[model samples]
Target chain A: MFDIAAVAVTIAIMITMYRAIKGPTIYDRVLAGNAIGTKTVILLVLIGFVHDRPHFLDLAVVYPLINFIATIAFLKYREMGRLD
Target chain B: MIDVMLLLIIVVCAIFALFMKDLLSATIILGIYSFIMATIFTRLNAVDVAFTEASVGAGITSVLMIAALSRTKRYEYHYTKLQRRKPSALFLKVISLLLVIITGAVLVYGTIDMPEFGDPEAPANKHVSPRYIAESEHETSEKNIVTAVLAGYRGYDTLGETTVIFTAGICVILLLRRRINT
Candidate 1:
């Protein structure tokens, strides 16, 4: 069951990778990158299920926590050109 | 089957990243590659490695690359005729291509003798990992084997990783902080 979800997400990741690579604008790439990050968080959890290793769920917990910070930092830097 | 599919996609992403003219798009594609690779690592039961790859490869590296791109040219442009005529540059490119091909061939050849995936009798699985798995709960009182190994038996390595992250945080502060009076 979870394997199906993982395969679906994997398909989504491939589609987003296409956009990330072939997108015409910088914003399109950024959006694709953000989408990939979110899907990665879900994929991480689904993978834990597929492997029957729930102990690794803590790792998935960290993905959403850090991925947003990365996406926001990228957008922030793009807008202001500085970290501060 | 899924692992093979993921591996193929990862290779495609890496090739596209190499061929991209826009540095920003390349960085983004590389992030996707990292994410998928982390997924593969998770599938292989290397949860600690996957965790580190997710945090460092997909998150920190993507952030660092974007920060770097903001300070540099967005596009990777071809050199002007004068710059392109430099013999040293052309020589370096030829040397790099040869080196890369040689190294890749060696690595591929090395994989031919590798044990099948998750082979229970593999030397890597035969060694200390089983002991760690058996003793970790009793020794560290931790339910997670990875956490137990990292934070208990290999505490020094985890300490070093923490120190590195701390140093990076400090460097970011030093570089990005603005003085009130200045």
Candidate 2:
């Protein structure tokens, strides 16, 4: 059951990757990349469980924090055309 | 039965995400995919991992993507063959495909030797992992084992990770910021 869900998520990620690669605009690629990052967090958590490690949740928490910061930074960069 | 169902859903969502023409829709679908994965983690008895996934994957990642999209165009332009095609592109694609296949094969081969899912006696359980699980609560006074591992035994690594994030944030700001008179 869980495996099926994971597989679905993987497929979704692949799709997102395609968009990232083929996206006509930079924003589209960014969107796809962001989607991939989001999926990655969940994938990491699922992997931890499959491995039977409940402790992996800490990684999940940290991953989002970092991912968000990175995204915001990129957005700001794109908006201002410079990183001040 | 449930696992099979989950797998099927995963496959379907993946296909949809891949084929979707609208970038926004695809991005949203990917978010859903992350949430489902988190649920699966919970089902697998990895509460810690599930928690992190829900927070980071569903929350932060989506926000960043949307922010990025808001600053740029939503749709991608498809180029027809008539526009222009470089023959070298075919070679690049073929090379990329080969690279992908080789990477995938290596990953699968590595998995083949892994202990069956949920095997108790696996080395992972027999080694420092067991010690960490057993003693983390007492040592850190933190109920969550994941937290203990991240902040305790691997404190240096966590610090490094945090530093990296901070650096990335700074770099982005520096790159994006407009010139100030000062």
**Cα lDDT of model 1 by residue, B26-130, tens digit:** 877887788888888888887768867877777677777777777778889888988877999899999999999999999999999999988898988999889
RMSD of each: 3.1, 8.2
TM-score of each: 0.83, 0.55
Each model's lDDT comes to 0.80, 0.65
Query: What DockQ would you assign to candidate 2?
Result: 0.13
Q: What share of the true interface contacts does each candidate keep?
A: 0.73, 0.14
Q: For model 1, report DockQ.
A: 0.61
Task: Please give, for residues B115-164, the per-residue lDDT of candidate 2 as tens digits.
Answer: 98878889987897889888999999999888889898899988997786
User: DockQ, per-model, please?
Assistant: 0.61, 0.13
Backbone-clash count (model 1): 0
As a whole number from 0 to 100, the lDDT of residue A27 in candidate 1 is 85
